[model samples]
Target: MSPQVALRKAFSAFPTGVVAVCALVDERPVGMAVNSFTSISLDPPLVAVSVARTSSTWPTLATRGRLGMSVLGSEHEVLCRRLSARAVDRFEDAQWHATDDGAVLIDDAALWLECEVRSTFDGGDHEIVLMEVHEAETFPDVTPLVFHQSQFRELHADR
Candidate 1:
């Protein structure tokens, strides 16, 4: 197998929580699916996500004053796939809410965070974005969506 395919297969062994990074751009809701979300610092309320360098959406989102990060629920698999697809309206039929600061959050997500871009760094093929959270909300009853082995999964506790 090619090195790229091998690396992707290896990475797929680890499960990751999916997130929807979105914002209101030109009065429209724009978003993308991401699985690289990470909480960086508690004291500073910082979080990060890696965006591909070739993403046409990131350029627009980066210019927004604020952005929303929604931890997708188990029911959001279809939405996640839609957001990740090319040449289609990501929010065509998606339900979402926009904050006063223009952060667009997916409805019924497990958690929502309103944030402002703090910094960015160069990654090999992606840009690592650091954002500072301005506000946050949680839906404890919602089950988070997980991505592993190129499939969307629901978290089940073994009690």
Candidate 2:
């Protein structure tokens, strides 16, 4: 296998939680499903998600003043795939509500975060977007979606 493909295979061994990094651009919902979402700090309430430089949605979302992050639940496998596709209306059949500031939050997510763009940095082929949380909510009963080996999965209790 090629070195790049080998590296991708290695990376796929690691599991990650899925998140939808979305925003209201021109009063329309726009977003992409990302597995690279992580908390950067607690004191200042910061979070980060990596977006590919070539993503068509990121450029539009970056221009928005605020963004809504939805931590995808196990029930969101189909939604995640729809959001990640190219040239499709991601929210055409999705149920979501928008904040007054134009942040769109998906229904039934494990967590929701209303954020403002704090900063952005170069991360080779991707851009690391740092966001400062202004408000947040969590659904304790929901199970988060997991991505591993390039496939979506659900967590099972240790037996």
Candidate 3:
């Protein structure tokens, strides 16, 4: 197999939590589905998401002062696919709420975070967007969405 395909297959072995990174741009809510979300630090409360260099949505989000990140629930499969689809309104059939500061969070997410783009760094084909969390909330009952091998999954409780 080709090197790229090999690498992609290997990467898919790792399971990741799905998150919707969103913000209000020009009074319109915009967002993208990301599986590269991670917590960076705890002292100051930091988080990060890796976005591809060719992402048109990233440019608009970069210009925004604040953003919202929603850790999607297991039931958000359709929402995840829609957010990643090209030439479609990401929020068209999705339900969400926007904070007064313009941060948009998907409804029923496992967790919600209000953040600001703190810094960015070049990653080979993607840019690592580091954000500082201003506020956060967790839904104790919601199960987080998981992505693995290009498919969505759910975590089953261990017996």
Candidate 4:
């Protein structure tokens, strides 16, 4: 196998939580599904997500004053796929709300964060974005959606 394919397969062995990064652009909801979200620091309330350089949505979202990051719930598998698809109305039937600052948040996500872009760096095929959280909310009972081996999975607690 090619190095790129081998790398992708290797990376898929590690599970990751999916997140919806969204915002209101020109009065419409715009979003993208990302599995590369990570918490960076607490002192400055910072977080980061790696977005592909070829993504058309990122350019538009990057221009927004504020963006909403929604930690997807186990029930959001279909929604996540839709958001990742090309040339489709991602929010066609998704339930969401926009904050006063134009951050569009998914209705039943496990957690929600309103953030502003702090900095960005080059990461080969992707761009690493650092964002400063301005607001946050969590739903303790929600089960987060997990992505692994190219499929969506649910987390389980061991007794």
Best candidate according to lDDT: 4
lDDT on C-alpha atoms for all candidate structures: 0.94, 0.92, 0.93, 0.97
* lDDT tens digits, residue span 1-159, model 2: 999999999999999999998888877889889999899999999999989999988888898888899999999998999999998888877989999999999999999999999999999999999999999999989999999999999998899
Report the Cα RMSD per candidate.
0.8, 0.9, 0.8, 0.6
What is the alpha-carbon lDDT for the whole of candidate 2?
0.92
Can you write out model 1's per-residue Cα lDDT over 63-145, one digit (the tens) per residue? 99999999999999989999999998788778998998999999999999999999999999999999999999999999999
TM-score of 3: 0.97
For model 3, the superposed segments whose C-alpha errors exceed 4 Å read none
lDDT of 3 by residue, 125-146 (tens): 9999999999999998999999
Tens digits of per-residue lDDT for model 4 on 64-133? 9999999999999989999999999999889999999999999999999999999999999999999999
For lDDT, candidate 1 versus 3, the one ahead is 1
What candidate 1 gets wrong by more than 4 Å, as runs, is none
Q: Which is the leading candidate under TM-score?
A: 4
**Ranking of candidates on lDDT, top first:** 4, 1, 3, 2
For every model in order, what is the number of clashing pairs?
0, 0, 0, 0
lDDT for model 4, please: 0.97
Steric clash count of candidate 3: 0
Clashing pairs in 3: none
Candidate 4's clash total is 0
